[model samples]
Target: MLSSKIIMTPKVKISYILNIIIVLVSFTFGFRYIFASAPLNYQLEAIGVHGWNDIIPEYRNMITTFVRVAGVGMTTASIGMSIVLFRAFRYGQNWARWGFAGIFLAHYIPLMCNMFFLKTTTESNPPMIPNLIAISIVLLSLFFSSNLKNCKAIENK
Candidate 1:
């Protein structure tokens, strides 16, 4: 009997490890927002009158509510995508590679823009440099690795 097992190349192994990193990073952000939102809000309030309080009272409330809701929503979505991508990539699904790359770009482009353009201080930018680097590695691994091509061929077989 012939074995049907797919051999994981080094690139595939690296991609898998990077995928796990992305999953951990996503869950960390989700839980951080879910648990620390109150303290975060307080810190934002303490920044100055030019911060959250500058807007009208009703608008400020609305904005705060929107932010909290969006944070939770993004957290859930990130986690969900992490799980889906993890499973798909384990089986060498080509779509998983593209999906992860697309999702990373979608989430981070605006985040990087905010970090670079909107935030004025290191304190305000959050500790996202490592996460950004991990994400970049995942993208590069997906795009340039021969393992992804092998995966695509396997999927088509």
Candidate 2:
């Protein structure tokens, strides 16, 4: 019989925890956007901010639709990726470690850049710090983990 045991190193444990965080956060945001988009859009329009009225109605609707679709797609992808990462980590798949690392970085880098570089309003400011810190911790934990090193070695064999 094939052994289906997962070795739990400190790094692997940390990675698992971070993955869970990622899933939870993604799901939270995903559901929030999916359910609240209409109201949120209306609220933005009411505030007369974020150039809500500057754009033509047709273009505005297109943008809103795009954002909603993207939000749902991202949420689904994140959940699927979380499951895949969990299985990969359990089976000691080196590629999954790298994949997760890459995906995490890709997903958050733009947000971080926008948070720091672009001028954010009161509405946007609240989530910036918490999100940055959380993402930083996850990235650091994943990169610094010894599990990645072991996985790399395994990949070479």
Candidate 3:
């Protein structure tokens, strides 16, 4: 129920390029912040932060594992998203929208939870870059996905 909209017009191409630009800007900052927080500590293990680990030793390991896993996910999703955006910038497409949505869905894993569970509001914590990116991605995806829907009805037999 989807197809590329590249042949539409030059206007559409420009629009898609603009959208991809926004997506790339958001994704870059989001990925950077996410990886910084959950840096890969392959050299050491279980360097749990204080005021939380005493009650749950398992929590430390769980968190460490989760961080590593999340990092992998984010990296993969980021690469996929970049591909979609690059395609959109070059060729334009309905798939770009759904592809962006997939990125948002992938981002919601650790990205959303971290914002929800670790929001300190103390001015010391980094801003919610991933959260904002996630929101933008979803919004953009739904917008373009709707356009694809209309095209699908006409294009499909």
Candidate 4:
């Protein structure tokens, strides 16, 4: 029988750790959106709409559905991105690096933009600190791991 355990190099290990952190952050916010009402209520309260569920139950449900959809998007996107990172990005695949960055930015940048728009238009401060941290981690991973000059050496091993 042949063994099939995989070993991680230092660079790959760093990428793996950072990718895990990104996924965890996404999961945390995703589950919160899906399971909790506090975050939605906070935004509602910010716009001077207290007891949103009591006042407009149907509207509340609609908004909650949107939030939950976003949560699902975040969780799903992170899982997909992690797969790419683990299988290809950490292996110095340039195409994987670009694909990950493009998909991640496409998914997250709009979210941040919506938060900013909400803050400016409705004075609602959505929780975006975690997202900013995740973006920073993503940038760090991409910037540090993007050097593919040694990819040939890695493949030769």
The candidate maximizing lDDT is 4
lDDT of 2 by residue, 82-114 (tens): 866766655666666667766666766775675
Measured with C-alpha atoms, the lDDT of residue 120 in candidate 4 is 75
What are the root-mean-square deviations of the candidates from the true structure over C-alphas? 5.5, 5.6, 7.5, 4.0
Question: TM-score for every candidate vs. truth?
Answer: 0.67, 0.67, 0.48, 0.78
Judged by TM-score relative to the true structure, which candidate is superior, 1 or 4?
4
Rank ordering of all candidates by TM-score, starting from the highest = 4, 2, 1, 3
Error of 1 at 83 (Å): 3.9
The lDDT-based order of candidates, best leading, equals 4, 2, 1, 3
What's the residue-level lDDT of 133 in candidate 4? Answer: 78
Query: How much does candidate 3 score in TM-score?
Result: 0.48
lDDT of 4 by residue, 1-99 (tens): 112223455665575677777777777877877775544755785657766655577777777787788888888787778777766665556666666
Better of 3 and 4 by TM-score: 4
- Candidate 3 C-alpha lDDT tens digits along 1-157: 2343334344444445545665565556546545553433321222333334343666556655665665566566667777776655234456666776667576665565555444453222434674676466467545644554233222323
Off by over 4 Å in 4: 1-12, 37-39, 148-157
Count of clashing residue pairs in every prediction? 0, 0, 0, 0
Q: By lDDT, is 1 or 2 better?
A: 2
lDDT of each: 0.61, 0.62, 0.52, 0.69
